[model samples]
Target: MKDVYGEAIFDFYKGDHSVVLTTHNTYGEPEEMPVEVFFRDHQDFTELENLAITSCEGKILDVGAGAGAHALFMQAFEMDVTALENSPGCIETLKHSGMEKMVNQDFYAYESKYDTLLFMMNGLGIAGKLASLPFFFSHCKKLLNSGGQIILDSSDISYLYEEGVAKPNHYFGEIQYQYEYKGKKGEWFDWLYVDSKSLVQETKELDLHTEILMTDEYDQYLARVTGF
Candidate 1:
């Protein structure tokens, strides 16, 4: 991830600052610059979508572009890119780099459109925002050019509710279809919270099509906009 704030932190740590505010030490600090709580590393970081099988190039829309990493990545490949970040602070940072074109408006209000809509960083959670999935896809479908696709990231949690894996949950509300696959014991990830059925059913309701671009024992879905 292209973390501008990270660069600042490094500068502070390497320079004359005796005190630093990292995650572990933040609570002990008297003054601290606020950070985006959701900021984290992408274990399943999205690279170039298979160009031969999927033309995820040309005009691209990267929704919820935190810190503009996706935009910078696409720019390196020479694709036309536009980012939609609701946070004013993020937009300001995106402007500083001038890596790609961007929109400060909400994705719902985005009108310029694109040939591909990218929902990297576990956009399933945002799409699964309390029945907004359908509405979100509707807007994406309307925004995409013909043959455009919606590529997003998600994981399968069905294994979590399976018979046995070693550890057990605290029995939190009817099992709730948690993510049980993919991930070494100690690695961390962004919160997408998507499983196979929910991801498929929700997108299908919006008339979009999906495909499992790349996955492992645990599932991570990259859905496409099939113009439903």
Candidate 2:
């Protein structure tokens, strides 16, 4: 996989704070993401993010911990936090940010037990497709300690389709994306945006219970999964 996303992050942390990362989505025009967003302080976090952070307990694994922002916040309260990132460049950035503990490994490939798995910024999209949720939850079950929870945020994205229009045969939330930075384009990857209802159903089948913790008008929501 192209490491363009991590390269941008490393550059921004190294004083190129003006860098902007662009993403080309399968269903929409390319979107620009500010590198600074990865470095947000606790006060700048959205209500959903703050809730996810506070809901965390015990040994916490910040999955896909891009720049270590969430992990750093948990560390402030002396929480046992470890950042798990795959990108070497982002790992370098995390080290420079003074993050105490981090693992440079892919989520599924890394084996560990955690009381809380934090997946902010739609981080659960790593599941790629709706069909992959079972495998995703099974892995979550393996990695989670007894009484552990998975705290995550995602968007419904159903509104992206017209009311009476014919939707695609595949799930609308299964989007393909590519990242671009400084004229470098990354490999395309699949990302998911499961609606709350479907998410609940999927987890239920795996004997996991999903709670809709909070939601906003934009169809974005925070959720917690337990009963693993």
Candidate 3:
């Protein structure tokens, strides 16, 4: 892997001035999106993101911490936060941006524990597929200290389909995505966007408790899961 996504982000962070993320998804036409790295400096955030960030406590791990935005925001409050990312280029960007703590490793492979596992911006997508939820929850369980919580956000995305249209046989939240930047393309990957109902059910199956913190008009929601 050449870290195509990371390279684009790095260029943007290094003052490229014209960088944008070209994203392709299974549900829609390709779109040119602003690099999230820029959002690090914005004071206004979505209600869901604000809820997740304000709810953080103790040692926090921001998984998939692209550009270290969420981690940086939490750190501003003097919270002990670590930005965990797999991209070397993004990690370098984090360091350059003055992120105090960082881990350049895949979330699943990292063994350390935390009081709060913060996953914003549909970070739960890392679960990849509905069937992988069990393993995902189990791994997160091992990574949490007693009384710790997983605060994350995701959207229903079922609205993407028309009323008369039939959805896929499997869960509708399972999505595929590919990245393109400066005429180069990246490999496609599965990304899950679980609805709150399914998420609560899965938490029950795993002996965890879940709460829907907030939901917006766009079908996006924030949730909190805690070990029993």
Candidate 4:
């Protein structure tokens, strides 16, 4: 897969004020994703994001830590935080941002224990699909310390489908997307946006306890998962 996303991140970080990253969905329409969104500071975070930030405890792992925005905030309070990112270009941006600890490895493949796994920006979408929730939960079990919490946010996305609209046979939240930057496109990938009910059901089966921390006006929610 081409690192179109990383290139965009690096470009934006390097002061490319006009850099625009676009994502394509099944609808064949390109959705503009402003690269600067990843660079937002704490003041610019949404209510749900603020909840996720305050929920962090002990050693923290900022999963999919693009641009190191959240990690930079945590550092202000002398909080132990690590920025985990797989994008090489983003890694350069993180280094340039003066992050104390940054790891360049796939989330599931990285072995480490942390009290809080902060997944902002719908980072839970890394699960790819609904059927893979168990695998995602299982990996969280390995990465969390005893009584650790997984603080993340996700949207319902069910509203995208109408009452009588024809939907795919699979879960509606399992959306496919491709990133394009400067005319170069990356490979398509599956991203999940699980609803609250489905997320609770999956956690229940694994004996994990989930608590809804907050829900924004757009139906996006912040959740805390523990009892691992």
Model 3 reaches what TM-score against the true structure?
0.94
Off by over 4 Å in 1: 1-55, 158-192
Comparison by TM-score, 1 against 4, better one: 4
TM-score between candidate 2 and the true structure: 0.96
Q: What lDDT is reached at residue 158 by model 3?
A: 88
Which structure is stronger by TM-score: 2 or 3? 2
Q: If scored against the real structure, what TM-score would every candidate get? A: 0.62, 0.96, 0.94, 0.97
Clashing pairs in 4: none
Q: Per-prediction RMSD in angstroms?
A: 9.3, 1.4, 1.6, 1.3
What residue pairs are clashing in model 1?
Answer: 150-225, 157-179, 157-180
Question: Against the true structure, whose lDDT is highest?
Answer: 2
Model 2's lDDT to the true fold? Answer: 0.92
Stretch of 10 with least lDDT, candidate 4: 159-168
Sliding window of 10 residues with minimal summed lDDT for model 1 = 172-181
Q: For candidate 3, lDDT tens digit of each residue in 111-209?
A: 998999998888999999999999998889888998899999999988777765468778899989889988888899999999999999988988899
Positional deviation of residue 223's Cα in model 2 after best superposition, in angstroms: 0.8
Reference-based TM-score, model 4: 0.97
True-structure Cα RMSD, model 3? 1.6
Worst 10 residues of 2 by lDDT: 159-168
**Alpha carbon lDDT of each predicted model:** 0.55, 0.92, 0.87, 0.90
Candidate 2, 1-228: lDDT as tens digits: 779999999999999978989999877779999889999999899888888988999999999999999998898889999999999999999999999989999999999999999998998899999999999888988899998999999999888787654577899899899999999999999999999999999998888899999998888999999996
Worst 10 residues of 3 by lDDT: 36-45
